[model samples]
Every structure is written in structure tokens, then in C-alpha cells.
Target: MIYRMLAINIDGTLLQSNGKLHKSTKEAIDYVQQKGIYVTLVTSRSFPSAKKLAKALKIDTKLITHRGAYIANEIGRPTHSSRIKEHITYDLVRLLEGFPCQIRLVHEQFSLANKYKLNHKLLSKTVFTTGDPIVYSQQFVDSIGDTIADEPAHPLSIEVYFEYKEDLKDVQEAIGKMYHEVECIALNDLRLDIVPTGVSKLTGLLYLAERLGIKRNQIVCIGDEMDDIEMIQACGLGVAMGNAPFEVKRAADWITRSQNLHGVAYVVKEHFRKQPQIEFLQKLNIIK
Candidate 1:
């Protein structure tokens, strides 16, 4: 099928396990954009963190970040934001107080977390997508619920990270039964991302598709995590990285090489090369 837009996840999809974007991945992205296909970074990372990678790749398109809670263009201006209601955010924070997990509230401009969690390794890992410090500000608080109540805004999502999957599972179940307005996504064994009920990479992309005037069927999405499952299921051409979990791979239409092997390059080169535009260039003795 002909595709007009490409949405790619950053972690484990574009960026390698070591948290670096490979040269091959950059070249592949450049080729796709040159072919006139809109390529966007769809990631679970904060906007600033994701923006850094997009800039590195020379991708000027808007990014779908925070697991689709926020959608913004290359300029870092949000086009759409789906946030948990203020009361719901407060309620979740309250419920989470009984647990030992680190709580962080993600906003468009900055992030606020419990001051006590600043040095926690799991929380630190959850804070920044890369080793480089983010341009955005990070504030620590005594109580996330108090912080949100005092300074109410559209928080992108609330991340609760635990020391083990069992803790995360318990919290997920509690949130599931307690609230119908929010959804709990176990990003891994230790982190659970709580966002609005319907928010996912697919919903975020749909909003972007509307803004770009592209049809849903014209979009191709690639990702590697459980948070990516919905978009993989919805996109016209869904690709899973070789390193992706079994379930994510099962949901994909195709599975490419692993991140370390430059899977993104493999997918883009294999698929976009077959497009009429690229084929014409090949037939004309231009690009090999």
C-alpha cells in the first residue's frame, strides 16, 4: 500500500538499546523525508527529550510524544494534548501514596516529582530518555497531588515506577477498578504510564493525521513496546522491531531487524524503495 506518513517510536525502535541513534537510522530517515513522506517521532519520551533526537535526525515534523499524551510539531508547540482530569490526577496521586513507587507528573513545559525520588535509580531512568540532561525544567515536590492542585495545568501523564513488576501490577489493577477515566500501561516491569482512557499512540497519530490532512490508511507506524501496540494495530503498515516484545511483534504487519542492527533503516529502505517515486529514480539511473 502507498503510504504518505511514517510514525516511528524512539526507544528500542529508532534508538539502540545503548540509547544512541545509529548513523544508518539517520540516513534512512533523511531518505524517507526526501521521498516526500512525512516522518514523525512517535515516542513515550517527554517532548524535550524526543525533540533532541528529532533534531539530530533532521526531522522537522511535529512529534507524537509522552505515549501520545502530547502532540507537537518540530517547533515544540503542541497541536493537541490529552490530559487526565484534575480530580482524577489528584485521586490517582492519592491512591499511589500508599505505595512505594516514585510518582512523577509530566507537563508540557516541565516535570514535577516527589523530592524523595530524585536519587532513585528507577525514577532517574524514567525521568530522562537519554543520558544528556533535558532542556526542560524538573521540579521536585512533597506531594504530587498537592502540586497539581496548587498549580493546575494540563499534565501530559502521570508515571508511577516501582522496584518490581508485582508492585506495578497491583497498582495497575487498582487503577483499573477504581477509575474508568484513566488507563494504566505497564511500560515495562517497573514503570506504569497512566493517561486518559482513550489516549495511545494511535489516538495521538489520528490527531496529527487530521492536522496534516492525511488519511489514517496513509500512515505507517513502527514501534517496539506495549505502549506501541495500539498504533501498530491501527496504522496502514505496522512494523515491529526485531527486539520488540512478542506481543508487539504479533500485532505488527511486519518485523524488521533489531535496533542495534538498524531496523528502522531496513524497514524504510525496503518499503519506501518500492514507491513509484523511488522506482522512477531507479529506472532513470539516478538512485541505485
Candidate 2:
């Protein structure tokens, strides 16, 4: 089948676990673009962070970021943004503050966050995919809820990070019980991106695809997290990394090599091929 668009997740699908983009992966993305396929970076990362990576990849297509709450291009102008209502943002921040996890209210222009001291090992996870503080306006305050009350900020999403695995689990369960308007997505064990109820990577991609006049069956999605399962199931081709968890792999149409193993490169090379026109084949008397 012919695919026109490739929507790939960043953390575990494109970039390696070590947070580096491989040379092979870059070449593969370039090769795919030459084939006239639109490659979109669909990720839970902040738009600024994702834009920085997009620049490195030389991706000009608009990006899906903040777990699909914000869709923007490399220039940082969003064509779409689903911000949590100010009241809801305040309530969610209030609830998240009860836990030990750090909370950052993510927006297209800036991020408002609470300062939580975490172990050195867990600190990298917070900074790596979220954004560089210097590049992005990441303002740390005493209380995010207070900031919300004072400024009435409407954020695209709320990012939470935990030092302990159990805190992540507990917050997931707590949010599940308390809020009906927000979705708590676990990008991995240490992080969660909570967005407005209807916002998700799949929904965001579908919106973009519709705007571009691309059909659902003409898209290829590759991801490695629970939040990724919907798009993986909905797309024409769904790919899971070899390093992906068992559940994510099970939902995919095919499994590629792990991120560290140049999985994106392998998938593009193996699947993208020249399609023979039926009329041309018939004219050559190859088949009926």
C-alpha cells in the first residue's frame, strides 16, 4: 500500500533512549521526504522542544506536540491549540500539588511550573524532552495553582514528573478518579502529560490529516507508549520499536528494530518503495 504521511513519536520511536538522534535516522527521514511523503513529529514533548529537534531533523512539516494539545510548525506559530480552561487548570494544579510530583502548566508561549526538588538521576528526564529553560520560558513559582489564580493562565497541557515510580502510578489513579475533563498520559514511568479531555496525539493527527486532505488509511504511525496505541491501531501502517513494551508491540501491524538500533531507518527503507501503475503493468502485458 502507498503511504503519504508518517507520524512518528519522538522519545522512544525516533530518538534513542539516550536522547540522541542517530545519523541513519536522519538520512532515512531525508530519504522519505525525497519520496514526497510528509513526515510529522507527533510527540508529547513541548512545542519548543519538539521544534528544536525538528530543526535538527530538517523537518518542515507542522508538528503535533504537548500530547496533541498544540500543533505548530518550526516557527512556533500554532495552527491549533487546545488549552485547558483557566478554572480547570487551577483545579488540576491544586490537585497535583498534593502529591510530591512536580507540575508544569505547558503553553505554546511559556510554561508555568512549581519547583520540586528531585533526585539528580530523575532531573534529566524533566529537562530533556520538556524544553531547555533558557530557550523556553519555564517560570518556576511557589505554587502553580496560585499562579493560575493570579494570572488565569490557559495552558495546552500540564506536565508532571515524579522521582518515584509509585508516585506516578498514584497520580494516574488519583487523576482518573478526580477529573473527567483531563487525560493523564504516561509517556513513560517518570513522566505524564495531562491535556484537555478531547486532546490526544491521535485526534490531533486526524485533525491535521483532514486539513491536509489526507485519508486515515494513507498514514503511518510509529510509537511506543500506551497513549500511542490509538494512532497505532488507526493508521494504515503501525510500527512498534523492538524495545517497546509488550502491550505496545502487540497493537502494532509490524515491529521494527529498537530506537537505538535505527528502527525508523529500517522501517522507511523496507516499506517505502516504488509503486507500479496498474496501467503501465497492463501495457507491458505483465498481468491482467
- In TM-score terms, candidate 1 sits at 0.86
User: Model 2, 1-288: lDDT tens per residue?
Assistant: 668789999988899988899999999998888777889999877788888889899998899988888898844568888888888788778877887778888777678778787664856544545675656787888887777777898888888887877888888898889889888878778888788899988999999999987788889998987889999999999999888899999999999999989999999888875644434544788533
Candidate 2 steric clashes: 0
Clashes of each: 1, 0
Error of 1 at 254 (Å): 1.5
- State TM-scores per candidate: 0.86, 0.85
Per residue, candidate 1 scores C-alpha lDDT tens digits across 142-181 of 8877777787745778877776567788989988999998
Candidate 2: list runs displaced more than 4 Å.
Answer: 74-76, 119-128, 162-178, 186-192, 276-288
Where does the lowest 10-residue lDDT sum fall in candidate 1? 125-134
lDDT of each: 0.81, 0.83
* Cα displacement (Å) at residue 239, model 1: 1.0
Q: lDDT (0-100) at residue 162 of candidate 1?
A: 77
Q: Predict model 1's lDDT versus the native.
A: 0.81
